[model samples]
Target: MKINRCGQAEALTKEMFQKVLGEIKNDSHRLIFALCWYTTERPSAILQLQVSDVYGSARVPLEKMVIAARTRKDKKTREVPIATALRQELKAYSAPSEGYLFPGRAGHLTFSAYDKGLRRVFEKLGLRGFSTYSTRRGSLTTLSRSGAGIRQIQALSGHASLGNLQRYIEVSDSEVAAIAAML
Candidate 1:
């Protein structure tokens, strides 16, 4: 794992992810975190999403939500397939017409605000070492453990390179032992 000044964010289990979701009372906030997990998109990019980006003209959720190049860290446009859970959230969410999905003073919801909200949820749930980026990291790790290839994950995450993407994947000792036993 790549160590950074702030330390790696803790990747959550499916149960922990669900706990976090249940803790968030606001529908928009819940959807935001769900998108973070399901889309593996950064909080900033998800916050900046326009209504049309995730919906069709008929107001149905798009099979793949468009992450414009301008909003992506890699400056490459990506189309992330919406997971069934996230599709349900989108169906229930009241996305604004022709504007930012999470509207704020400057246009979209600020990263700071999102972070603060998540921090509160984490604290209430007694979760530690989790951050706004945790869902993205957790989702990536979950996909890796579920037998997704590096290239396939890279396509979804829009990482600049495989090495960068690898840094996000976490391997537990139990998984290592299981692999050894199989071998």
Candidate 2:
């Protein structure tokens, strides 16, 4: 059997995801990381997110954030409900009332900057191939392995078809167990 090297990208377990989240010091960056894991948003779409996307108003309860059609790869808009716990964490963040979530020299953080930062952290932890894209891929794999239906996963990933979504998900050990148990 072929073994993945330290640098090769691998699907993450819940524990591994938590470890990475703890290591990241920046709240905005952490949110970005969490967003990628919690949903299948492309890095660019994440950078484009604004505070208004989440918190509707002090009076109105927070609701789902809409990923505008222009920002999505499929050119389809989706309203994603924010995780309740994540909402609390976001409430504590000190972002502007109106602006990009992670502003850089340009309007939003450059993809290079986000990638380089992630790579630096991955290298420090003596891991490889854990690029920015890995979060979404790992998340989808995780959801699938946990027995989430394919259609549900497809909804979150915004993948055009079942084939594309399946292409990225890895069969988890838990899934193997479940299948074997079925016999």
Candidate 3:
């Protein structure tokens, strides 16, 4: 099974999100997953984020919450903005502007380490096949199904094109059955 398709892509009902958040032992881990769900950014981009990227004068109206990060992917830099939920979580974990958002033991956020942690979390939660990337896919899929247009999703997800964005949204057999029933 595709790692991204491991489980339900629905936005992890508020209760489930809270449950998973509660299971996290540390604030950093909670912030990591919260940021992932809010930004819908890839693990690499998220791990690459630095404190400066989230702050700085360039981040205008910072008090309004929701900051954008310049992500380097596909030979281009795409700006992805955070959501309100993530902003609040970030505020709670606020670190110095020169440090890493999710610092590792070595003092830098590493995608490999983060992925491993996420895997363990999934295992402990008895969820199979789901990977860290599932957060991105889940966020995008949820947004798409909730009446968000392709362009809006592409912008928020930093996808270069609608085609690329569509690939992340997996319409399952259950959805098809529901649609047929409606018809």
Candidate 4:
């Protein structure tokens, strides 16, 4: 894994992501990370999600989950389609009727609290440099590798600009070699 500046978190490969997810024994915490991975949202926005934003009257997962504008770094609300993995996690979790999904005394789950739990998981797995942002960056990189258009990823991630979004994508050496061969 490449070490980046303070603001940048190392992106995990899909296998590494699964390993991290499996290490998380807490159901709520597992769901939290799954939401982060699948929705490609920041941990703060994911933590602030209202139960209604994810579930309907019968506690069914919505097709699209809303990341509230207020919690977003760019303050732009985006509806992310729930991936199958995230939907399964949501189903396993018993969500409350209303209010924050991960509620804390201060209103919603504090970033520090979430980070603490994440840090423990990482330490146990001997992973260094991975943060809550890892999932978001990983998801974007995965999308880019899968041939999704940069504009599509930008929309999904709600990035203010393509340049900012591009920074999150990690180009593999093999991918570069393949492009060189094509040339």
Candidate 5:
């Protein structure tokens, strides 16, 4: 399988995200896109999120979301902490406790549907070879380049090994040029 490089994935412009969000007619779709982009979660994990997994009171600002995920890759359950931006987005599109985070027409989200949505978004943007996994890769790349350590990223992303984490960190040509400029 061809994995998306971190550099190319991070290169996903804000305009692209906005365009995709705008194209989504349903409130649920927009919310799902926001969650995926903000949390850097795999579609499978994202699909499994429940309203109860989010821990914040209505009295307080919904800025923090606690996501409990059971990843097939890791075969372990992990909790991911998301920031206010994503939390606020989710709150804006809040669903009932029994509802799926990204409910489909059938009333529950599926991995295949999530994958198709991501592919459609990329296709609309004229970006080929991009997949939902790119979101996770982009998140890891952004954090790593921002000075986060492998251990930190591993913890946040639930990767089993540093080697797997390293695969997500793509050194870009711009980065190379920037470094050369300093020399």
Candidate 6:
């Protein structure tokens, strides 16, 4: 269905995201989807993450920390403080050291694979106009509407410049209503 990562795709609603999340049965795939929704980082970055990056040899608290610079697109490290629920999910997965979190036949799950997997989920749901960027975009839009400053959103997004982050947020009509209601 030609789901482009550019601005062509609109941010998905939480319910819609959940529906897609629910459809993914594989534990690795579920974690990938959850991480996309939770971290708001690039899907490729999440896919490139090693087992040690997520969990060390021993258990640890889910602190706000940079998820290894190796996987980052900008090559600039960014920190995401994950939720307790997601932490538990990661812990439950029990990954081995020195390997990609979501491994496929060709080593790690490629961007195309992640994109295609998500595409299949969306197609099954009869959804249109969403892509790899949807979860990240949707999270940013939600944060903006919830009264988070642009910089705060940028913190999670790791947007290199101020102008770059603005592109991810699509202001909604309800946001206008929210402004009017606040008066």
Work out the TM-score per prediction.
Answer: 0.91, 0.85, 0.78, 0.92, 0.75, 0.85
Question: What TM-score would candidate 6 get against the native?
Answer: 0.85
Model 2: per-residue Cα lDDT over 1-183, one tens digit each: 113433435666667778887787777778788877776677888887766776666523266777778777778887887777567656767776667767888688887877777767777886665777778778888887688999999987788899988877877688699889999
- What are the lDDT scores of the predictions, listed in order? 0.87, 0.74, 0.67, 0.87, 0.65, 0.77
Residue 171's lDDT within candidate 5 is 73
Candidate 5 C-alpha lDDT tens digits along 128-150? 65666666676667787888888
Candidate 1 on 87-135: residue-level lDDT in tens? 9999998877778888889889888888888889988987888888889
lDDT per residue, candidate 6, 4-101, as tens digits? Answer: 54445778777877888889876777788888888888788898877656665564534663577778878887778877867877877756556777
Pairs of residues at least 3 apart in sequence or in different chains that clash in candidate 3: none
Q: How accurate is candidate 1 locally (lDDT)?
A: 0.87
Compared with the true structure, what per-residue lDDT tens digits does model 4 show for residues 1-183? Answer: 436426578888888899999999877688889998888888888888899899987999999998889888888889999888889889999887789888789887788888889889988998888888899899999999888999999888889899988988998899999999998
Off by more than 4 A, model 4:
1-7
Could you tell me which residue pairs clash in candidate 6?
A: none
| Model 3: lDDT of residue 183 | 75
C-alpha RMSD values across all candidates: 2.3, 3.4, 4.0, 1.8, 4.1, 2.7
lDDT of 2 at 65: 75
Consecutive 10-residue window with the lowest summed lDDT within model 4:
1-10
Clashes (N, CA, C under 3 Å) per candidate: 0, 1, 0, 0, 1, 0
- How many angstroms is residue 157 displaced in model 4 relative to the true structure, after the best TM-score fit? 1.4
